[model samples]
Target: MRQGLGTQLRHLIDLLDGAVSAAYEEAGIDYRPRYTPVMRALEGGEPRTVSQIAEAAGITQPAATQTVTLMMKQGLLEASPGVRDARQKIVRLSAQGEALLPQLRLCWQATRAAADSLDRDMPYPLSDALAEAIAALQTQSFGARIRAARATTKSKKETS
Candidate 1:
């Protein structure tokens, strides 16, 4: 039997992230794949609010908040009051996170080369496919597609 699309996508993510996680472990870096986006967002050395981080990282605010909270707990990020908004928390890399830059840069370079090699082996690049898929979903969401299919099914049933 063929695997479902969701299952296959999950398996792909697991395989990719598992290898990435192992790479960090082997390099003696205690970081998670999820943290990379937020780190990238804050790597510019400018403090930004959670909404700004979310926008910069191409992630949802809630996801950014969760990641920022976790990173803060791990001492990789520091949060302070936004300049004009006392309730808004501006986030930036902590000293520890700054210290990891050189190591992470090396790891990122290696990961990029490995990804290039992987793309060369395949007919279609995974990164391109991901971008295309994201674009398609932005055009017509999965829920919309499912609802259209459901309507067609109902029409077929009514015709019968």
Candidate 2:
């Protein structure tokens, strides 16, 4: 039977998550799935507030707060009072977290190498295409549309 597009997309996400988790495990790092997306967003070298990280990670503010708290407790992140907003806390990777970047990169490289080994013919091109797809999906319009659609569907279901 042919899978629906949603099912295929979900499966692809599951595969990627599993691969990434395994890579992190092999590298002897504790992989917090919820925090990975936020950390990835911080790769641009900018310190972000909890709300900003929540938006980037597609999670709720409370979820982001909890995740940040956990990471801070684990020495993976440092939080300080925001310069502009006294009520908000700015978060950034701690020295220990920064020190782990090289190891994280190595894990990512191993994961990429494994993926490339699976498809020897056009690995680089396939990787490039995936990167392009991710970049395209990162647009604000794409995310806003997705959120709106979900909200509409939920409201309709509730009324029914």
TM-score top scorer: 1
TM-score of 2: 0.60
Q: Model 1: which ten-residue window has the lowest total lDDT?
A: 77-86
Candidate 1: lDDT over CA atoms? 0.93
**Model 1 misplaced stretches (Cα beyond 4 Å):** none
**TM-scores, one per candidate:** 0.96, 0.60
lDDT for each residue of candidate 2 in 32-127, tens digit (9 for 90 to 100): 556676677666668999999999887779988998899899898888898988888989988887887788778767767877875577646667
- lDDT to native, each model: 0.93, 0.80
lDDT comparing candidate 2 with the true structure: 0.80
lDDT of 1 by residue, 44-71 (tens): 8998999999999999999999999999
| Pairs with backbone N, CA or C atoms under 3 Å apart (clashes), candidate 1 | none
- Number of colliding residue pairs in model 2: 0
- Top model by lDDT, which number? 1
Regions of candidate 2 where Cα sits further than 4 Å from its true position: 43-45, 51-70, 114-160
